[model samples]
Target: MARVCVVGSVNMDLVFAVETLPAPGATVLASSMSRSPGGKGGNQAVAAARAGADVVLVAAVGHDDTGAALRAHLESNNVDVGGVIALPVPSGTASIVVDAQAENVIVVAPGANGHLSLSSPRLRDLVAGCEVLLMQLEIPTDTALAAARVARDAGATVLLNASPVGADPAALAQLAEVTDVVIVNESEARHWVWPVPHLVTTLGARGAVHRSAGGETRVGAPAVEAVDTTGAGDVFAGVLAAGWAADPAHAVRRACAAGALATLVPGAGDCAPDDEAIEDALN
Candidate 1:
């Protein structure tokens, strides 16, 4: 099995299920409150691990209780946490509001995730020996870029998932140059600097478009009512990385299938489906 390395954030998610999202300064009572382990980086790692891959997580958490809990969560999911760092300052957290429709609004505090620089020995070592290196924008851009450079030099397939909006176009292009695969949502597609031949744009239920030097193909999503869209993209990227690690030719197709399967469940990381479930759905 190919080894997967993820360098990103690990956060404790505080979720509130409400009837509706409040307008500016509007006071609305929520129906329920919940906590879950979620971070773009951690989510992807767990997704791949659950899909039966040798997954290693390289990220930072705070020394606070939230960080400890997040670490435990990852370990419980069978993710290799040998590269995780717990910083003494600024623990990671995400405040999420989910409406009855399962629509969510989130605000994240990078806390220790911002402190995860490429200079860390833990990150460097983990990146050195992986088949695929998965990264996201939840961490510092410099750190993300640094990891890309390292993974590229080390001859590992690098995939960049640009999320959370704001990013420099020039930097995005530069990062894409080194990435073997670039997965972006429809909204973020305009940020790419290069005319990538091997790029994927995820378009909700409409499915995804995969373009490369040879040609392009559109993978259709199965018609299914999605209870929660959270982590759907993470599942897309994670499964894609795992499949690519196994066989690059079929990565996009397999990932699109897995992403569709993820919509069958609810919540973020908790919703990611296993490989058999995805294959069953696809077949």
Candidate 2:
């Protein structure tokens, strides 16, 4: 299996299901509420593991029950948690509101995620030995970039998913310099001009487009009714990272299928499809 290292955040998601999202300064009641393990880093780690990759996640969590549960959840999903550290802070939390259309609005409290640092030798070694280093913006941008630099120097492929947009342009540009492929949603794609070797823009149900020095290619997604769009983008990025080194186009197709499948279920990490399920979707 491909070995993928993820340097990002981990959070416990508090989800509320509502008929419609609240408008600005408006109050709304949710029909139901639940909690789940999520975070761009954790979600992508689980997604890659399910897609048959050896995954290691480098992140931090609070020294609390929520953090313990989050770590256990990742372990249950087959992700190596050796690099996960517990700190004297509250674990990260994301309050998500999902509407009937599977669209969502999320607010995150960084908590311990804000304290993640890549200063440890063990963590640096972990980052330097992976086949692919996957990252997101939920954590400190400087930390993510530092990990990317270490991975890039060790001949590893770097994949950055610049989500939740709003990253410092100068820092993002520096990250792009060391990244092999940069994945983003349509909106995020327009947020910055990436200087990476490959840029992949995910188009939701329409699929994704990949551009590189060689040229550009587009792939279509399988049709499916979305139950909840949460973590679908993470699924795409993780699945893509799992197979990208072998075949870029095929990886995009698989990632598209896996992402579409993710919407059939609610929540994030638990919804990722395994290799067989993804192949079945493709067939």
Candidate 3:
């Protein structure tokens, strides 16, 4: 099994379900509202664990009840939380709206997540010890780059998800030098930060595409009735990393299946599908 480390952001997701997404400046009533644990980092970490990876998370949450609850939740799910730190700020949060068709819009407030700096020696050392390092744009760019450099130096394969967009060039270039794989969606693929040769692009209902030095392979997603589109990408990343060490080809297919299953539920992180669920979906 591969040892995976995820260093990124953690947040509480406040979600509203609606019949249709409102146009900009349009006020509409929500069908329902709920809360869940989320954040690209948190989602990927939990997803990897559920996908059967030995996972550790390096992140910071606010020193509040929400943070504590989240920590306990991840711990219960079998992710090592020793790398998670508590900072003196409000926990990060995301306000999300999902429509009847499961399309979503989100706004994030990075509170304690902003306090996670690149200076943590512990973080670098942790990355060095892992077989894989998974990261995202939810954290500071410099920190994500630093972790990648350390993990690469220690011979760990680095997988970066170019998401939540808007990454600056310098960080993107540095990451390209160290990253083994870059995962993105169609829109994100257009904005490739680094010229990484290895790439995975998720194409919604069309499935996902993986490109490498040899050629490209496309895997079809399992058909499912989507309840919420949130966290589908995260599930794909997690499943990809989890199966990568043992079987790259099968992993990609499993990843697509897991992502499809994720859409059958709402929220992220804590909602990742289990192995049994993934296998069932594939059947």
RMSD of each: 1.7, 0.7, 1.2
TM-score of each: 0.94, 0.99, 0.97
lDDT of each: 0.82, 0.94, 0.87
lDDT order, best first, reads 2, 3, 1
Please identify which of the two predictions, 2 or 3, would achieve the higher TM-score against the true structure: 2
Among these predictions, the greatest lDDT belongs to 2
Q: How displaced is residue 229 in candidate 1, in Å?
A: 0.9
Model 2 CA lDDT for position 250: 88
Candidate 3: Cα lDDT at 255:
86
Off-target runs (Cα >4 Å) in candidate 2 are none
Quality of model 3 by C-alpha lDDT = 0.87
State the lDDT of candidate 1 residue by residue for 1-283, as single tens digits.
Answer: 4699998888878888888899999998987888888889998998888777899999998878888888888898899999898778867888888887767788998899989987876678789789899999999888888898888889998888888668777777777777878889997887544465478889888889888887888988777877667788998888888878677656677677778777777667577777787777778
Clashing pairs in 3: none
Selected candidate, larger TM-score, 1 vs 2 = 2
lDDT of 2 by residue, 24-80 (tens): 999999999999999999999999999999999999999999999999999999999
Q: Runs in model 1 with CA error above 4 Å?
A: none
**Residue 61 shift from truth in candidate 3, angstroms:** 0.4
| Sliding window of 10 residues with minimal summed lDDT for model 1 | 190-199
